[model samples]
Target: MKAILYLPLCMVLMSLNLAGQYAIDAAGSYVKNGAYSAAYSVGEVSTLTVRGVHSTYVSTSGVIQPDPLSITGTKNPGIATIRIYPNPVNDFLRLETDRTDLIQYVIYSMQGSFLAQGTVRGMSVQLDYLTPGMYLIKFSLVDFHESQSFLISKL
Candidate 1:
């Protein structure tokens, strides 16, 4: 008799738990059409906005447009795209970019103390002197009009 009474209660509790797993709760607004969608959320702590073009095909290719807004507090129209490689680097870090102008770089500790600064010579920077750890490197054009920073690991 007790088993029969507990069976229905157990099933009810199990159903409520299972239903919560599929619950969809969204706090922000999302608009979707055929190929483009935009979402934005405003909260007391922070705000986020996203806009993108959807790719329909299975190949998964879409035109990536450059973000016109500059987040570096610079007046430049856009930030230059730079590539750094051989991360978790052993000795040297290489920088590659299409810009012909000189670029200045500064290496700083994770605690925000300046460690090193120099121009990219031969498209590479000798990081062997840095101790094994994580560092932040900021790269800015010679004009100082635009800059970007990346986190890198040294090993």
Candidate 2:
């Protein structure tokens, strides 16, 4: 008798949980569709307005969570498209690009000290002089106004 009653109670609780999952999924879809405001909290401690693409959260304790996308920022990834290989390079580092003309490169230490600067000679630039560590490479195309930064490793 008890086992039969227990089975129905368990089924009821499981069904409610499954329905809640569907409701949350639908709410997430609505959030992706348009800007909408929603808040949830345990008791009256904190109320967060996590709404749309630019949504954020805040608590009564004054803690806050900014929109994730804004935190990282954004960049064009322009010349970073070019292949730079033998990374952790021992000697020369190559900058392979279709338009090599008028290209200028400046290498800087991880600490922002100017290490090397020059035009692209062929496809590769010499890093034979640099001590093994990390460096930043800034590449610029004179007329094109195109620039990109690359974090490189040396060995």
| Candidate number achieving the greatest lDDT relative to the actual structure | 1
State in Å the error of residue 19, model 1.
70
- C-alpha lDDT of candidate 2 relative to the true structure: 0.69
Error of 1 at 8 (Å): 91
Residue-level error in angstroms, candidate 2, position 153: 0.9
Regions of candidate 2 where Cα sits further than 4 Å from its true position: 1-80
Q: What is the RMSD of candidate 2?
A: 14.5
Cα deviation at 149, candidate 2, in Å, is: 1.1
Model 2 scores worst on lDDT over the 10 consecutive residues at 21-30
- TM-score each candidate: 0.50, 0.47
lDDT by candidate, in order shown: 0.76, 0.69
lDDT tens digits by residue: candidate 1, 1-155: 99999999999988883533121223446566544566544333432344458633322122223323334453544567789998989899988887867999999999999999999989899999999999999999996488889999999
